[model samples]
Target: MDSGATSESCFAKARKSDKTRRSWTEREEECLIQALKEATTQGWKSGNGFRPGYLAFLENHLKVSFPDSNLRGNPHINSKVHVWKKLYGSIVTILSKSGVGWNDTEKTIEASNEIWESLIKVDNTARSMRHKRWMYYHDWCEIFGNDRAVGDKAEHFAAAVQVVLTMTPELPNNVGMSLDELFSVDEGGAESTSVSLTPSS
Candidate 1:
């Protein structure tokens, strides 16, 4: 047999394959939005954190796909929440090193900018996972009826935000002074789009 194959053979093999290619639907997005909004409100920033659950819910259920990685990153393990987990981890690092008071409001922007700068330092294209996580957060908010996620991108991670906000002389009226708290809403009936993030952030 020749080493090369014809287009007909390839087509025949594809047709014979048992599995079907997965694509997204609107209903899946609806369920995902509901689950995420609830999770974000009730347990949005859990002890482990938010992004893990968010991404898992999609890949496991809603079927939000991921882009193929040319750089050898774990494509099968990608999700909105997972991206946030990594970004939040980075944010936490910057916060831990800052040693800024939790109640020192003056350092809020400074700490925030540092975190953002660190992110830019890592990737200037603004297409980094951290930046994408922020886009996910912002888009989620827009769908959930919020003008924005609130606070700087640095505030996206609670562990980091808490360190700086707590140091502030006065916390926000919400009382938590963390990204989790600041972005939280009632989530009573917040049903919107899903995390069908199938490539191209």
Candidate 2:
């Protein structure tokens, strides 16, 4: 007998997924930053911001079992994502550009290379290409390289980017450097600044 229809369970998508964040300990933070430095030394500067390959490289390169932290598992690929951004700055970057995601790190890097190829092909800045299925080098690294896809694969990069943005000292603002270093605690639950040349008498 042909079943009329096999109904799908509503709770299918709601499986108990493992929490995907490792606490941003100092050592991991150091490894992450060092990875960035290595990339830079290899001509992978964040001058125009981040790149997908760079992002993948960072995540993958940080594959070492960093001594100790209250962290759990995701099979530990070539890397983990988002720890450095937490310790340092935000990833989104309003002023800078952005990257896109593919199925895996390979796809992501391949996508970036393809876009770069096209940009160089036309001999334009490819300025118009930002976030339209692809992105410019600067934009790709800053945006797509920073953001994750619509589902669970997104990990910690986005959060880290946010941290970077928060830390970034922009115009018409004084709250740079973690928003903590710039202010006092006794504001009574208000967001104000405390910049004075000297302590008043």
Candidate 3:
């Protein structure tokens, strides 16, 4: 019995399992994002983020969309969502900085090499974002922008809320409006109501 051969076979098996676990096609990501949007529309999402069981909903949705994907709610969908939130946070951080900006035409973050180097020093994850196209930036904003919570998870959400409020146009007869009211969509309407952000007394 060759122990070295046995160990190599075990290592190969582990690598194969990991590859299978990490495989996510572009179509699958699109499907997941669509499902998340649907979940938000259905009111599964709230101020604190998606309610419990949303993962199961997403898993079932993906299963129906791709019967052979074999994705699970526990790790596959959960891990992907976590990664997306982190990526979104990194992008938001990049844009929040004075030297960085978003390139609308290229759908990528725009920053000088010096700026990129500075950001990458603070966050190593930003390295991969250089000149990388992020097609789902707006979708991510829609999905996670309104999340209001305490601590680290809410950091990006708070920044995004500020950005959205700054971009929103003021309306006549606007005096006091809560964040919810500002972002609320009219009944049977596809667009969100535009309201100015006013400081609460």
Candidate 4:
């Protein structure tokens, strides 16, 4: 069998495995947002210094939000360094997009180093994962789901946007900015037809 077909088969299996693992619930979203906020407030500079309190907070959240999720003893969430690194990615993405910068010199330096290290890790991870069949399977499953098609690029694009839309509400509100402003609301509080998924020729 061709590599592409083999990869697609694996991807389909992964998608059918569980929708819950692929996407987070609204409660989980709120918890994640709150956790990040609390962690930042507690001076969580990097993965190395991830506090025990934060881990406990997240552990409680997982227990409450996903009682059946077998998150207990899960290295992904239990390991201090691993959880911190993942949450660091979320912080970097949000703060960078919001054009927020650190005021203190120590914090600024730490944030800059974190961003640089994260970028290198991202590049290295992407390169290493591309060669692995499992990575291809997971990536394809995430983008196209079980109903993968030959030319469903538009659907994939729309799905990606929908994922972003879900995260928008979780983003922290800044002093002069808000995610709600991104959408143009009409008289009845409905999004206008101007925002479209179809590619214009």
**Which regions in candidate 2 have their CA more than 4 angstroms from the true location?**
1-18, 64-201
- TM-score for all predictions? 0.26, 0.27, 0.67, 0.26
Expressed as tens digits, the lDDT of each residue in 1-201 for candidate 1 is: 443567778877898662333333445435555556655666444532344555555444433332331211124224433444444444334334443222233223133556566655755632243322232333343233221222222232345445656779485655546465565544465431122112345
Tens-place lDDT per residue, model 2, 1-201, is 233232233243334233332346656656665676677667665433454466656665666545343333332322343332321122222122234333332222223756556644653434433334322233234322433322223223434344556777473444456434443255465322222222358
Quote model 3's TM-score: 0.67
Please list the C-alpha lDDT of all candidates, in the order they appear: 0.41, 0.41, 0.77, 0.44
* lDDT top scorer: 3
Winning model by TM-score: 3
Candidate 1 all-Cα RMSD: 16.5
**How does candidate 4 fare on TM-score?**
0.26
Say which prediction, candidate 1 or candidate 3, comes out ahead on TM-score: 3
Count of residue pairs whose backbone atoms collide, per candidate: 11, 22, 0, 0
Q: Which stretch of 10 consecutive residues in model 2 shows the poorest summed lDDT?
A: 87-96
Instruction: List, residue by residue over 1-201, the lDDT tens digit for candidate 4.
Output: 699999999999988665324344556545554554555556643433344565666666667667776543334344533433443433333334323343343332123545545644744542322212221222222222222222222233334555666869775545464434543345364222222243569
Evaluate model 3: give its lDDT. Answer: 0.77
Model 4 lDDT on a 0 to 1 scale: 0.44
